[model samples]
Target: MLVSRCKFTGISAPFSVGAFVKHLAVPLSTRLHCALVNAEGGPQSRAVHCPKFQALKSHQKEQLHLYVDALLEWNQRMNLTAVREVGEVMERHVEDSLSIVPPIRDSYLSRCGASCGKISVVDVGSGAGLPGLVLAIAEPDWQVTLVESMRKRCVFLEHAVNLAGVSNVEVVNGRVEDIGNDSCFREHFDVAVARAVAEMRVLAEYCLPLVRVGGLFVAAKGHNPEDEVKNAETAIRSMGASLLQVCPVESHGPYGQRTAIICLKGHPTPRKYPRSPGTPAKEPL
Candidate 1:
């Protein structure tokens, strides 16, 4: 039987008056800042203001700052993301990543055992570790594995892992298709998550195989996704997965909408899944 052993701590933080005035380029509000800070570490973790970041736990907010800074720096050399300013990182990158918590928690609980101990999760095609590293940093218990096909991105992922001082995370340099078939990877994880990687059908092929029976495959999508869900039904079923639910996610204050498609693995994935790296992308289902 599937169960939920995962614990999600939502970080919440608010900006002070001085912080608001400094980032005049973006209309920063104390309430929104507070919501995001809280969302990052949750209400109980810690809270921080500029110059001095105080919280129940020291270093989470600072760690968040460092990760954002690294992404911004690397973005200059490679086009990782368009969010240029620091404020944008808090809104677009940080909050956007954290918004998946509800769906992730709900899906896991409905399926496998509670999210405790070394609950495994693999992020397929984790370009710069969007939800993977972000989730790892927030919830320390998850044994997070980030799989990346590109060499440069893998290097950046390693740097991010070390910078974050996260011991529970690992970076695997390979295509999702190749990694999924490895005996060690097939049916190995409690959850498999992908964000902005591809359409649902294509992603199911790349992700579902890595999830054990009764585990979940969560696909993070932007905006309305009714049609994509419909198109992926056949592929999802073929991969021994069934769509369990679709959860809508939004930032606490004036944030955009995000969708997470939760599919539960009903049986062991076919051994031939995750064909060639480009095959799924080239021809979904």
Candidate 2:
């Protein structure tokens, strides 16, 4: 039997794993409350409000649930996320991923005239498919590519995609640095995004090369990332991108606030960029 304890309310309850899985389909309020269970059997985390998850359609919700189920099951075999409980996954990962949808969509629409055509997006360092898989699930018309270097994570991504039955996602098993230089991937996407991948400077090199001149590169960052944004200014300029805006997003937890740093690709990236595999992190611009 598994026991769940609420950190804020100090409430405890015991239930089987099977029962917990079944409770995933319960109403948002109940599920959100139940998600506070801590993985260490201690008090659960505080409840999070996910307006984005609340906005999902029934079928979309079903797909997300399936993906979360696979994530929790696979996590037991390998390290995926620190938050193991289902509700926490929904709050921290699913809803956190969903938070970027509006910014990406609105940014594209505001710049591209709202034609609503198919947009190509690439997710760099997509460990466990945070925004990549979640984005594909939310926007069916968009083509999303999940780039993960680890073969094991790639396998898990494929399995989760298959289980969710989402056909718009493609899992690639390779380093982002190499992919950035590949003709097939370089400058081929409408937008590129990364979350918890690296610092802003190093992350800019990995993602900007994959975006076309008129495209966007969004980095999911923690709250109070002004210093990081300032430090990465040189790197951002070197990558042919200009700092567009730093948009505030929903808080992930006690982390205060989260933000999305949006950069506009104005010119083609220099061939020298992404500098050899493992080079970017070793010596950033």
Candidate 3:
């Protein structure tokens, strides 16, 4: 299980097979092959699974492999994910995103309020489409919009989504706030996702307006998020929203614990929301 955790963490350092099991909680079996250290800087080491994560889930393993291959090949010409290697992509990008699936799905269901099965999703500030692409690949039934304002990143996202052969994913070149106000997009999605974008207050403005009254805005962030959340209270309340939960994510790879702040809209957002392009960044609320 410890090795499983390391697989999720994407540990990069190398070590002798015996020393690995001694220090870490992973199973020590003659079948296990090699040990690698954490790439993100830590003495914490990880033993490579003998058969790798592929063996565990043979059915969909090939699809995951294909996605990583696409990401790496694309990164060479156009930037996609920060972690360039295959192992890092699987653990850090894949598992890390999947860890939040439960909340995202639940939040989607709550928004649908009886439509519990599948729903549409909008990934705001989808740089290289982190959780958005991952979620689209994992749940093909749901439609996902990859909203990005940067032209180059949008090009990369479009290429990546097309190359992945993921019919459910669409890349939109525009700011979240601008998209949220569009007549076609206003209150159009069941769930909205943002990862490492702006602070909570600013994110609320960017995301809340896009979701229907009962929909959710899920903000993915690093370990400590209290100050960001506290700072967003006014924006959250004023927007007819409330904090649902601050879900702590147990890191599966080199990174440590993460957090996903779930905010729910209690009523329709005021028409003034999103306040011109850089307004949220200039003044949070």
Best by lDDT: 2
Alpha-carbon shift of residue 8 in model 1 (angstroms): 34
Backbone clashes for every candidate come to: 27, 1, 10
lDDT of 3: 0.66
Candidate 3 on 138-203: residue-level lDDT in tens? 777788888766655665565556555677877776656566667667788878888767778888
Tens-place lDDT per residue, model 1, 95-176, is: 6677776678766775666754458988887887787988887777888988876656665676667776877788776666
Give the best candidate by TM-score.
2
Error in Å for residue 241 of model 1: 0.5
| Model 1 spans > 4 angstroms off | 1-58, 252-255, 274-285
Q: Count backbone clashes in candidate 3.
A: 10
Overall local distance difference test of candidate 2: 0.75
Candidate 2: segments with Cα more than 4 A from true spot: 1-49, 113-117, 251-254, 276-285
RMSD of each: 11.7, 11.5, 13.4
Q: Candidates ranked by TM-score, best first?
A: 2, 1, 3
